[model samples]
Target: MKVTQRAKWRYQQVRQARRQIRYKFKPFKHTRVTRRALAAMVQRVVDQSQRYTLRAHKTRQDEYKIVINGWPDAVQVTVGVHSLSFLVMQHADFCDFLLWPDCMPRRKHGQWRCFDTGCLASGPYHRLEDLLFNHLAEPFLEFLTKVPEQAQLMLYDMEGMHHACVEAVKPLKRLDRPEHPVVCWPLPAGSDIV
Candidate 1:
């Protein structure tokens, strides 16, 4: 069998077209959480938490910033007319995570937004606290627990931040160990000698 150059070109073109069509029709794997949805999650966490206090203050003409203050850290959520920005602060450690909305067309230098699909999706989270606790608090705590090793090779790092990491991990030290059941069983009299 002989294949012409024109036939080979047509075959490649058909394959390229099929690839494009498949790419265009592919389903999105995850859903994005909008500003309002994130705000509601933060509000719910604040409400359910006994140790945290919520405060609201007007930031702009129509924008309001909600601040959640408590033990591990504090979260500042800026609710604007069309966008939302979140800033989670570990006051003692001076470490913070600022997350801007993904909907924004442009972002300033050094700005970051959430990139985790599971964290942004509402379907996986039955209660808002689960979303907030797992995504928000857990990440910061994990970072705090690793600061010392992460900064060990650095020539210079913030002393206070290291101090804060110690303070944060002190209470959580017990969690690093596995608990063993304490049980005592009396050996039978006829059992073999040890």
Candidate 2:
């Protein structure tokens, strides 16, 4: 083959390889082994006193099955869960703890989008945990203030990701919703959340 032809062939191969790498793995697809592995990894990291329990979903294996249950405060709440994927591509990880409140609406099956600025928290794994905690702390605490002591909270993590965009807010007369206690921290216009 001519030198130019050989070079062209190599370039095509490289392009195909790049494309395959880009789309090869869909991490959100939940398999039995993947769920078990995730549960074990999370158990290893969480504190023993936390008594975090891993509950597997009988169905919806494609979504996150194991939920990390623990108390962030006096209120017994779910700290977070191990899920695959992220809203932004910058800080994508093999697994992430999508914290409560943020993880609340995310668990529902429907069209999901992030209108809040603090959707994607970027940093190292530990720092990412801190960010997740900070994002959820206020809302969860307020929820505890309203929730009756006898009531139980089940923390479940779902594995579905959607890109976030800016949004305009309307007037709010009521701020309390027993089912939804989410507090959104809006990003400044054209803010860099990478």
Best by TM-score: 1
Cα lDDT listed for each candidate: 0.39, 0.34
74-186: candidate 2 lDDT, tens digit per residue? 12123333323212122343122222455211211322222344566332233223333334444433332343332232221123332222224521335235332223332
Looking at model 2, residue 73 earns an lDDT score of 23
Off by over 4 Å in 1: 1-33, 56-66, 69-134, 137-194
Q: TM-score of model 1 relative to the true fold?
A: 0.32
C-alpha RMSD (angstroms) for model 2: 16.1
Candidate 2 residue runs with Cα over 4 Å from true position: 1-4, 16-77, 81-100, 103-126, 148-194
**TM per model?**
0.32, 0.27
